[model samples]
Target: MTARTPARTPRRTLRLPSWLPVDGYVLALLGTVGLAALLPASGAAAHVAEGAATGAVAFLFFLYGARLSTREALDGLRHWRLHLTVLGSTFLLFPLLGLAARGLVPTVLTPQLYSGFLFLCLVPSTIQSSIAFTSIARGNVPAAICAGSFSSLAGIVLTPLLAALLLGNSAGGLSADALLRIVLQLLVPFLAGQFLRRWVGGFLARHKKVLGYVDRGSILLVVYTAFSQGMVAGIRHLVTPARLGLLLAVEAVLLAAMLTLTWYGSRRLGFDRADRIAIQFAGSKKSLAAGLPMASVLFGPQASLAVLPLMLFHQMQLMVCAVLAKRRAHDGADTAETGGAPSVGRITPMTAPR
Candidate 1:
């Protein structure tokens, strides 16, 4: 038999692909952002819409609580390395970038967009999407699940605190009141779900698809409300194509810097290749779904522009990471094919459910 090494992807391809491609959800997100850029809304109607949007944001967090599995939490215990990597990336590396980017204000990116750019770095990683991609790529599904979950849990506190510390003066004078609001709006609901986890758990598993729609819809509503506020606030007048191009370049650098840091940092910390991949992918991605709603709450109408850099970076990460993930998979295949070692990713665990 010809000696063929197994394939392992670069630590990069560990995240989902749609994040990189012009997929449906991303396109939908861009459409909403573009709509806001073109037609900003105002008046008492805007106020009412904002109120509704705020309520939806709280409810979305509540549902997040209710949907997460108690059973899975137990399984997550086994993947500590993967989970820690994701959390560090989300809470530690992401915030540092947000802080560093602040020095660029009025030079490359406008002050307002720069604040938004910083806030983008403050949000959590995506859960469903990350896990979904990891599973599809035949990476460690359990580790992906746990890692994504841990990042979200940490973000409930970290994202708000980081924003307060890093983007305070820039985020329209963020108040302690906003911190309390985040706790009440996001943390409380999530805790409640944990409290009621046993009862709500089954309900969510059964209605996962329906709940997914609820989650996406809630985000869309948040976008509409925030865009309406931006319209009322005239944020559109401040952003220009040149400034946006500059923002993209800066964000590109930031994403690349982060990807390099997290991937190598974890390896230096002695994580295996699987874990290193998870860290690089999960750490590098900023959640538009999580950030958009939080940005609305934290930055109010100005959130429309603030989240723009994040939105763009979110897509950029998706594209770059998709290619990387595939390359990693192929690398694994080649490694097994060449080395004659049975590829770990392709081997089904005897314990796995049939």
Candidate 2:
């Protein structure tokens, strides 16, 4: 009765990294935009840079094709509901928002920038970040894979079509040449990558890091080119800091609104929590990859100005979504503690259309 050991103290700690929240990426993207504004590249060097960036974009997609496994792609196909949710958000929801925001022309945003805004709505959902945030939130990783793939695949066709139909005049009146350009320069190469995947897929997956460099480097070139054009054309004057801030605020509201609708709407539509999370993350993002090249091709000398809105929104979505994904994780800690997990995380790459 006399010998009683002192009770041990329990460690108290919070996992800071686990709580990074999707909004963090929004800030990061904003910072990136600010940096781009500060230095906005210029001159003939910019053209060379732009050429290099275009090459990079094709290569990046090729690597995307290589990294995806056929088996995983089939597995992802099994989760059709999740995929549709993302598609609905990308194609349906985003376009609606773009239409609603049209009243902002010449006040908060210019018509050309508004065209860029509309284009961002039509572009595909992001692949890497969508899968990544879904994984972090302990959501449906396979669903994320399929949903993201579906979005990208559909965007290749749908974006151009929807633009022609809804945003035809806005998108420079969609000439036969422009339609041909989408089919030839964009879709054709992507499909080619998918067909050749069997041969180089293994090599790509093994060397993803190296290829990622190729990807980032290419985007950098596009960035320089787009900015240089803007600098040459005096497009910056149209997008003052105040207007830029207003655009971000508008985009943030747009992002939050879409995320909320997709998440809760999916639940109401009878999707499970895991599927809802995947849908929300996958559906809400805009593909910077798709947007940049399409802008370059569609808007001509004004492509940079046309792409500026999207460039801003891309970073905004990433940062805001990053923070949101993490928050959802913490909020769902109780569910995790209850020992329920639909599946462990796994992200499969999507095939690029050649």
Best by lDDT: 1
- Candidate 1 regions exceeding 4 Å error are 1-20, 37-39, 136-138, 172-176, 345-354
TM-scores, in order shown? 0.86, 0.81
Provide the lowest-lDDT 10-residue window in model 2.
345-354
Please list the C-alpha lDDT of all candidates, in the order they appear: 0.74, 0.72
Please estimate how well model 1 matches the true structure, expressed as its whole-model Cα lDDT: 0.74
lDDT value, residue 40 of candidate 1: 55
Candidate 2 residue-wise lDDT, 1-354, digit = tens: 699999989988865453233343334444544555677655576666666766665665555555556567677777776777778889999999999999887788878778778888888888777878887777877788778877877877888788777767656566888887666656777777788888877777788778766665556566556666666777767777887788788888888899889888998999877788889988888887667776665665677667777877776676677677767776666565678654444333221111
As for model 2, its CA RMSD to the true structure in angstroms is 7.2
Given candidate 1, what's the lDDT at residue 21? Answer: 58
lDDT of 1 by residue, 204-301 (tens): 88988898788888898788778777776776689888998899899889888987997789889987666676667677787777788778877875
TM-score of 2: 0.81
RMSD to truth, every model: 9.1, 7.2
Query: How displaced is residue 148 in candidate 2, in Å?
Result: 1.0
